[model samples]
Every structure is written in C-alpha cells, then in structure tokens.
Target: MTKDTTILLIGHGSRGREGNKETINFAAQWRERHPEWRIEVCFIEHAEVLLDEGLDRAARNAKKVLAIPFILNAAGHVKMELPHALAEARQRHPEVEFLVTRHLGMGREILAVLQGQLDQQIKAMSVPDPMTTGVILLGRGSSDAGANGELAKMARWIFEDNDHELVDLAFTGVTWPRLETVVQRQVKLGMMQIAIVPVYLFTGVLIERIKEQVARLQNQYPQVSFALGTHFGFDKGIFDLLDSKVNGDIEEGGMLECDGCKYREAAEEEHLHDHSHTAIGGGGCAHGHDHQHEHGHSHAHGCSHKHD
Candidate 1:
C-alpha cells in the first residue's frame, strides 16, 4: 500500500434502492477511470458500507484515503458527522493519511450541466422551440432553512441572469411551491409549456414522485406541457467539476490549519437555512451550527446532507 493510493466515495444513504445506487454508480465510474487506485463506496445511513466499513477494507492495502462525499451540499455530515468518522479512521490507521473533501456547491460547471440538461429536455420534447418556453427548477427541498434559501437564491440568479422567461424554484418535499402549487403558479404566469428540472446530482425515486405529482397537475392543466429533466450523474463534466475543487492547497495530511477557510465565508451568506450555532471544525460561518431541524423536515432552502 502506497501513499494516496485509495479513494473512498461517500454518499448520504436513503431507504430507496435507486438513491443508494447513484453513489455506487459514481464509485464504479471512478474505478473505471482510475483502475489502479483502490476505490470503495460508503453511505451515511439506512444501509451498509458505513464509512468505517469502507475504511476497514481499504486500510490494509491503502496508505492514504480520500473520503469524497457524493452529497451536493456542505452540511452537518460533511461538516461534523463524517469528519468525526474520518477522525476515528485516522486514529485507527494512524499510518494512513486521510482526506475528507468538500461536497459539491456553487460550481459554474454544474450550472452548465444543469442548463444543458434543460436544453436537452426541451429538444426531446420537440416543442417547436424551447428558447420561448418557461422552465421550472425543482428539487428535493431540505429542512435546513439556509440550504433551501441558497438554492432558491441560486435559482433566481440563474433565471434572471440567463434571460429565461420564467424559472420558479420548487421543492418536492418539506417546502412550499410543491409541484402542484408551482404548476398553478406557472399557469397563472401564462407559461403554456414548462420543464421540471430536478436540481439533483442523480436520478432516484424523488424524481419519479415529482413526475407523478406533475402528472396529476397535467390532468388539471392539460394545456401546460411539461418535461422532466435528468440528473447530473457520472458525467465527465461533473467529474471535472469535482476535480477542480481539489487544488494544490489540499495539505498532504488532510487537515486544515485553522478555523478560517476562505470558502466558508463565501458560502455563509448563500444558505438561507439557519445554522445559528453549527460549528464546522469549531468555527461559525455566519449563523452558528445550532439551528434546529427535525428529521426529514425543513422550513426553507436546501442542502446535500439530506439524502435524495
């Protein structure tokens, strides 16, 4: 086992089989590219391959491990839970250096990926021309108010900046403007054709459910033509986007020197969900990490720590 030889991709697990498979698929893609690099996939909960289990299997032959979370946002798991688990792995395999990479957020390339998916969906529907039609960005909303707010903000910036006719950010669960409500809103806005772009990194039951919800709305508003978009799964562009996040600055030992990471400050204002007292490695972004959230619930904005 040599240094920096193994990679472990981590995902927030779900009870749905396909939700978990997306992470496994990502691992498979990484393995395909870096066959020599030992790779394993793990989950945060609701299934097997817990971080420790993956670490245990890779520890014997791998001197270095990078626990790259497949989650889309930086929340408690990436900030707290997984790091705690990584800390344990570090102690047990003292010789093996460990790195826990940041989750995906605010990447320009991702925006491109999403825009491309929307474009493709428009083309597939053969709806005369898509540039004139409206598009709605949908997602599995989160309980983290900050995270939910961030997505809505991002959606607004994207919509306004791109000159799209109408782009409403809606959620599938625990948030307002659910598919039906948003559909009605779009109807009121005089959008005859709409595309429901699931703002997710992978396909799963949530997308299916959202589609079902859309179907019921279609019955009510048959004049409103809707198209379901694809998730950003295992795409080369996505991999490149993740690769860009890894920079020369990642210390060899996988530890930050202090509390003030430059990226955190930029992200602090982005999430609208409260993190009043939450600590990432013992430092507050803006609101601390103590913002309260009940399981599978949310008041606003969305983040990745929640499983799809």
Candidate 2:
C-alpha cells in the first residue's frame, strides 16, 4: 500500500464506550503494525467520527481509498448501508478511487480463534467431560436470514471438530432460538456443563447482557454449570486476517458476496422487466455505482431500499 492510499476502517459503532474504544485501539495497533500506510477508523452509528466524516478525512489527501467494514457478516450494514455510504463518498470525491474489501465472514482463521476460546474455557473447568458438556454459540442476530444462517453454519463447524457433546446456535435478539430458550433446552437434555460463547468482535453492552443472562441462568439452575465465554477482542488471528484483507490482491477492487442477499434478489427481479442486471465483479459495487432497487413489497425481514 502506498502512502497516498488511505485505509478506512469502518466499524459497527456500539452504544457502549468499551466497544468503541476497542475499535479505536485496534486501529491504533494496526497503525503501529504498518506505519507506512495511513489508516482511519469510523463507526456506522452511536460513536464519534461517523462514516461520512471518516470517508472525507480519508479522501482528503489520498489518491486511493480502501474502505473495509470491520464487521463479521454480510448483513444489512455491509450490503446496503456501507455501499450507500461509499457511493455518496464517490460522488463527493470523484478524484479519489474508493474500493471496499469483504467483511470478516466465516473463515478458517475465525474458526481457529473461536476454537482457542472454547479450549480455554473448557480447560478452566473442573472436569471437562465432552460427553456431558453443551456449547451454545451465540450470535448478535440479524434480520437477514443469510447472516443468521452463517452463524448456524459456524456453530455446526465448531461442533464437528470439537469433542463437545452438543453445540447449538442461539441469538441475542431479532431471531429465533434465543439464548434463554437454548439454555433451557440444554438443561432439560441433562447437560451438566453448558458454555455460552459469544461470536462478537468486541466488548459492548450486548456482552454485559450475555454475562447477566449467564448469571441469571446460574441462579435459576444451580445444578447446571453455566460458563460464559469471551468475545474476540484484539486477537492476533483477527489482526492477521485484517492485514491480509488490506494488503491482499483486492487493491484494484474488492468483491462483496450477494448470495442470498434480499436487496440484490429484489433488484434483479425488478431489473428483469426494464433493463438487464449488469453483474459487477461478482455482485459488488466496485467503483461506487449506485444500483437502484425497487422494493414494491415487504417481507418478514422488512425489505427496504435503505437498511438504515
């Protein structure tokens, strides 16, 4: 990466200060790792230096800008909001080339990090019996079914490799199979030890809520051992993944996955009547071209033109 290029690190801002602080700290550490490249951090909501301002700052003196979403899945924010922001930024700064890399989706490195967390938690147990333990991989659920499905798939992947008796998927909110429901089911199934692992990137209000939930479960079911796992914060594995994304072969353009994306499907269906859908770099807005979609109706996930 050249000095003229600015790497814009975009995070999904949280209501809690710790979450926002983690993002800033991550950016600072990344800067230290690569002092040659200019990096700027911003949030999508609920934090300082919003996306627009961050993009402006990045485009100020840079010839090219790589906007990377510091998120886990290709949900609403990544598919709709971030792309819209990039499109607006391109309109504002036509001189600078804006490209967005893929979000931190499910990968082997992520699985390795999660496996390490699970191993640490199980190691701390008095008698870590895989046959008697139940692991619940919790996710900050989204309205997007594809995103939720990704979490479910990740849970299965963990279960397949680990020696745990059972591994199931649960969500904090906005989806079915909630944490409490899963815990209840696991307790009924004679699980002596149940570990609730959060697949979040940073410490935030949601993490606190999960901790409180674990405590409540402990009180309710004194016989069952409930252990709350840690979120991925400043993990070297995550840093390496981000480094690869930034400095990898996606310098010219990055591809965004639109598999099972509601917006893309709706848009394609609409375009079939008037104009043919021109697929761009495997369904991504490379040069910030605004692909307008007509959301004539709403689905259970609340289909909208803008994902807010």
| Top lDDT prediction, candidate number | 2
Per-prediction CA RMSD (Å): 7.5, 6.5
lDDT (Cα, tens digit) per residue for candidate 2, span 180-232: 99999988888999887899999999999999988988999999887788878
**Highest-scoring model, TM-score:** 2
Model 2 stretches with alpha carbons more than 4 Å out: 249-252, 258-308
- Model 2 scores a C-alpha lDDT of 0.78
Model 1, stretches more than 4 Å misplaced? 1-4, 127-132, 245-284, 288-308
Q: Give each model a TM-score.
A: 0.78, 0.84
Please, what are the lDDT tens digits per residue for candidate 1 over residues 111-148? 77777887787777785444456778787776556566
lDDT of each: 0.65, 0.78
Count the clashes in each prediction.
19, 0
> What's model 1's TM-score?
0.78
